[model samples]
Target: MNADIKNKIIKYSKEIGIDKIGFASADPFVTMKERLRVQQENGFQSGFEKGTLEERTKPDLLLPQAKTVISIALAYPSKMKNAPRSVKGDRRGIFCRASWGEDYHHVLRRKLNLLEEFITNMYPEERCRSMVDTGELSDRAAAERAGIGWSGKNCAVITPEFGSYVYLGEMITTLSMEEDTPIEDQCGTCNKCVDACPTGALVQGGQLDATKCIAFLTQTKTMLPERYRKKLGNRLYGCDTCQTVCPENKGIDEHRHPEMEPDPEIVKPSLEPLLTISNKEFKNKYGKISGSWRGKKPIQRNALIALAVFKEETSLPSIIKVMNEDPRPVMRGTAVWALKEIAPTAETKHLLQSFKTKEEAPEVLEEVEKALADLSSQGGMYV
Candidate 1:
């Protein structure tokens, strides 16, 4: 019966499309506590610091009776016809594959539920609960402890078969299963992920400052500080620079999941679409998407910043017009900055005259004033 339960889980998990599953005793991962302590001191986690997160990383906190953890990984296909992740003449934009789909939270949690049900049917005496990255538990650490994969310096787990593009989840339960030994670190002398980061946020070993992390900034609601905007390139939602440069990811057989394909508009999206996405269309296009979870204003602002970096003079007219209409000052401020950098045409000069008089935020006004000065220097009227 014990062997049958184990085999049933492996068999069923494969059938459900997961790449790997492993079990580990739910003993407190002593190493994880130290890692979490160090990471907390770094203060880089930012918005990820809140939620049921604190308790979930600690096995005992989630389920006092928990005696086992089952770790699961699902691979996001690496094949991109657009060649965006590569750095050749193509210069692929980096996007970590994990987030490319329907939130793995729904995808893996449903699987975890089925696995739990399968376990309980075998032993009705046990209790079980499952979670994806949502659980307070350190899903990465559990994956390492369960021998699912080694934790790479990029802070992603990499198995030989899936490379580093796998998503992780956990099932904490009262029933103990035979545990697997953790994989050895294979990222020997590899600094590609660290060096590839446009921001110096990955300055130290496995630690990262998510505040400076482009992935976090793309999704954040507040205006991004100027220091990091230069590094974001065109990414509006997430960044995958480190993962793309990982040597381990090379020669990977691309795995495709139709569950999360890039909506062409969002992928390499034009500044025009961002500046004009209405609230209704924003909800319809991004309601289930992680990028639009914070709404369109932040993303639109990011798009404007991206345009500024590219010096895209063509988008000037539409962006300059919206600088006055966007309700969020941050969005307006971003438009002001982008237009000043990229547009500053005769029409823009006319609008900034009105903008200069009515704008209220001090920082935004400062940016507006600077943009006006820059435009004036180029012989565009700024009065």
Candidate 2:
């Protein structure tokens, strides 16, 4: 009876657009508990993780009669079709591929709801709980246990069919089902993702130091540490270096779901315009994507850093304009950094000197002082 129901569930999942689905015993994640302890002790957490260690590792704690976990993966497009050009004067910043479409939380939740409905219909007495990324259960851990994929060294669940470009979600159900075995790690001798990481976030094989991770760093609202500014490159939201450099993800571009499609202009938007985007405009343009959950401040700040990385002399006037007028200290301070990097002129020094007198925020004032110190090192290059 369980076998028949499981098979039907799998068929229905595919029919409802779930790219991949697998089942596992709803046993406590004993091994994962140790890993979480280590991650917490080392202060490697990104502070965005949900729930306590017990809640995350124990299945029955969430759903009293849980017998099996149904893990699902939906593949998203890896490459943007006809992506807009990032030219000299009109440079654009990018949101990572994971954030290209509608927020995965919404996409995966809707799919899970459909699966839960199907299960309840088959067995009217059946009870199920569904969760996406923000849920108490670790989506990757559940996916790994359910045989949907193996946990990669880069800390992503990599499926043979979709590489690491899939969004994961899961449902805990009272119905007992035949469980699938976990897959073997195929990463073997490849260390490309570790070596390619701009911030050395990958501590070792299958471990990540989230604090140093560019993806985590990008979401921070305050002044980005000076060291990571250059490492941020053109990324406005999350980092994809680890996935991009992984051997498994090579040539993988899945565009099966239309809702997962990206708008080139919105994902890789013009840098200058982002600096001045109003709250309403930011909402209208980016609210649908997961990257915008942190709001416009982080994205705008990242845009200023990107302009600095490009040394876009053409954008200096715009940078100066924001530095002088923007109310947000983080934005104003970042603009100062960008201004200094783009060949600070005598006029620029005068502007900074004048601004320093009126700048009250210690954070913004510190940035002004640093820019002036850097300008002084140029030895009349700006004078």
Candidate 3:
């Protein structure tokens, strides 16, 4: 009966646009718990994770009498169709492919809810709990155990059909079912992802130092550390370098879900305008995407860094406006750094020096002083 029901659930999943589905016993993720402990002890966690280790690893804790875990994967497009170019005067910043299109949280949750309803109708006495990425259970671990994909060295779930370009979600159900065999590790001696990581965030195969990961760093609300500034490149929300360099993900561009399609202008937006985007405008533009979950400040902050990285002289006026008029200390401080990098001219030095007088925020003032010191060290009259 469980087998028949399992087959029916799989069929229904495909009908509802679930790209991949698999089932596994709802056993505790013992190995993941140990790895998580080490990650926490080493301060490698990104502080975005939810729940205690036990709650994260034990399915029964989340839903009593859980017997089977059903994992689902939805493929997203990797290559942007009609992608706009980022030319010199019009430099652009990027949100990672994961943030493309509508927020996967909403998309995946909707699918999960549909699956839950189907299961309850089939077995009215049985109970089920569903969760996406935000849930305590490690989606990748559940997916891996359920044979949705093997855990890649880049810390992504690599599916046979979708490569690593898939979003995962799962449902823990009380009904027992035969479990699918887990996929064998296919990444033999493939270190491309680790070797290509800009911040050395990969740490080692299947492990990541989330603190240094640009993907995690871009989502942070605080001022990005100076060491990781240049490493950010033009990525405003997340980093895709690790996945992009992986041989498995090479040439894998799935357009299975229309909702996951990216609008070129939105994902790779011009940098300068972001610096002064009103909150309402930011929301109206990026509110649907997952990247905007942390709000517009981080995206705007990264835009300043991207402009500085390009040394975009055209954006100097905009950056200066932010330095002088922006209320946020992080924005003002970041603008000061952008000014120094973009154009450390006599005018810029004078502006910083004068701004120092009225800049009451210690952090912003510190950035102003630092910019002035950097200009002085260049051995110029700007000092």
Worst 10 residues of 1 by lDDT: 86-95
Where does model 2 exceed 4 Å of error?
none
TM-score of 3: 0.98
**Residue-wise C-alpha lDDT for candidate 1, range 244-327, written one tens digit per residue:** 889899877455466756544344444556678789987876666555666777777777887777776666666767787777
For all predicted structures, in order, the TM-scores are 0.89, 0.98, 0.98
Candidate 3 lDDT over 1-383, as tens digits, reads: 77798889999999999999999999999988998999999999999999999999999999999999999999999999888889999999999999999999999999999999998987899999999999999999999999999999999999999899999999999999999999999999999999999999999999999999999999887777889999999999998998899888888999988899999999999988898899999999999999999999999999999999998999988988998899899999999999999887888888888889888998888888888888998876665
Candidate 2 local distance difference test against the native: 0.93
Q: By descending lDDT, how would the candidates be arranged?
A: 2, 3, 1
> Cα deviation in Å at residue 242, candidate 3?
0.6
Give the Å shift of residue 115 in candidate 3.
0.7
Candidate 1, residue 66: how far the Cα is off, in Å = 0.5
Residue-pair clashes per candidate, as listed? 7, 0, 0
Q: Rate the local accuracy (lDDT) of all candidates.
A: 0.74, 0.93, 0.92
Which runs of model 1 end up more than 4 angstroms from their true locations?
1-4, 51-54, 82-96, 344-354, 372-383
